[model samples]
Target: MSPFCRKVRLSLAEKRIECELVEVRYWERDPDFLRRNPAGKVPVLKMDGKLMAESSAICEWIEETCPEPALMPATPDARVEVRRLVQWFDDKFHSEVTSNLLYERVNKKLMKSGYPESRNIKAGAQKIKFHLDYMSWLLDHRRWLAGNTMTLADFAAAAHLSALDYISDVDWNRSENVRDWYAKIKSRPAFRSILADVVPGFPPPAHYADLDF
Candidate 1:
């Protein structure tokens, strides 16, 4: 599962926007898909007859177009924090953890790429401890990742964590704060579709969709 795609889904759901979901095999580089996005990335959004690529930009466009149930803060400073945390998860956490674990363990098999590398998995397992600890620290100070209110930052972090949770890679017990935070977000109505998602070859754990979990 692509966390980037999940993040966009969360944004749309939170805004109460109705959208048709399309599954694309970006790696296959289908001509029509490439025409929409030459970069060949998943999570591309086609809205108002225009093809939109890049998850973050597409999300910002949605936020701009639909202002209700705002995912971004009103103040510039608060918005920056949201953007910063969004970047943190999408870039740093992604390179260090997701690409190492989910890509290796799941994407490899799905793409028929290769076997999972133990070293990368181990590195991802270890790095996640630090990220969880950091999340715990952040939760210690604020109600949400970027501030007291839930924003795009929460969805960004949840996107990656939810995908990893699907594969049972996240150790929720590592931090009660982080665990509690996730349980809160995971219970939202917007998360319903995410919880119900199922992959062809992999079945999620029982707790994956459990709201109390």
Candidate 2:
């Protein structure tokens, strides 16, 4: 699955919002898929007989409707911090790292788009070091990505990283804090389904689902 789709999936898992997983290849731009989201994104969430597009908006709606076991901070200021980090991973990290590595290596072959570009793959591999260090630094001081409590920020970052992990791109030994943080999150019930993700012709590394890793 795409990182964007995984982000929404993680939120649903965390909130215990039972939903069906319907895989859609947005690149094909199927007519029915386009109707759900004019943008033709994979993560079009349907609940209570209504359709919702966009990851950020759907996540916020989930937070509002399912308040228990909150994924957002109670204070406005803290929530502002969470949003900032969420965007940081979703936009910045996705562009620099994910597009470079995962898209180049995985999406290309899956969609028969073209041969994977070497330059983008190399760039993604190099840039992931910086992002991992950033995560390590954040974990050193805070209990989670945004703050002390687990929030949407953590799920957002994890969603992208986990996709990379599926392809065995992440260097878990880069930082103890980051690795430990991942281990903790990885063991959660919310993370179980993610570990089970399988993409045809691209088998996951053994460590992808290993909690000890």
Candidate 3:
């Protein structure tokens, strides 16, 4: 599963917007899928008679249109922080961790690209500890990642972490703060569908959907 897609899904769910879920094998370069997103990347959202690509842009459009139960903060500084963290996860974290671990282990097999690379997996496994510890330190200061209130930053981080958790890549015992923060976000109604997601040939661990976990 693509964390970018999941981030958009979580944003829509949080906004209480109803949308149909569609699976697109972008790697195949199907004409129909390509028409929707020329970039050949995931997280394309079609709404209001328009095709929108990119998770950050889609989420921002959603927030601009809905404007209820705000995901971004009111102040400009706080909003900048949220955007910064969102980029941190979607860009830096994705490259260092998700691409190495999830894409290497699961996506390659799903796409029939190639066998999993042990070196990338090992690098991902090592890098995640640093990220988790950084998250713990952030939690030690603020109630949520980026600030006191739950924002898109939290969803962005959760999107990546939840996908990794689906494959049991996350070590919940690494930090109590991070674990408790994840548990809180994982138990939300917005996370129900994500928790129920089932990837063929890759069954999630029992703790995957356990709210108590």
Alpha carbon deviation, residue 53, candidate 2 (Å): 0.6
TM-score of 1: 0.98
Cα shift from native, residue 112, model 2 (Å): 0.6
Mind sharing the TM-score for model 3?
0.99
Better of 1 and 2 by lDDT: 1
For every model shown, what is its TM-score relative to the native structure? 0.98, 0.98, 0.99
Clashing pairs in 1: none
Lowest lDDT sum, 10 consecutive residues, model 2, at 15-24
Score candidate 3 by lDDT.
0.94
lDDT of each: 0.94, 0.91, 0.94
Query: Which candidate model has the greater TM-score, 2 or 3?
Result: 3
Local lDDT at 156 for model 2 = 92
- Cα lDDT over the full model 1: 0.94
Rank order (by TM-score, best first): 3, 1, 2
Candidate 1's C-alpha runs over 4 A off are none
lDDT of 1 by residue, 91-176 (tens): 99999999999999999998888999999999999999999999999999999999999999999999999999999999998999
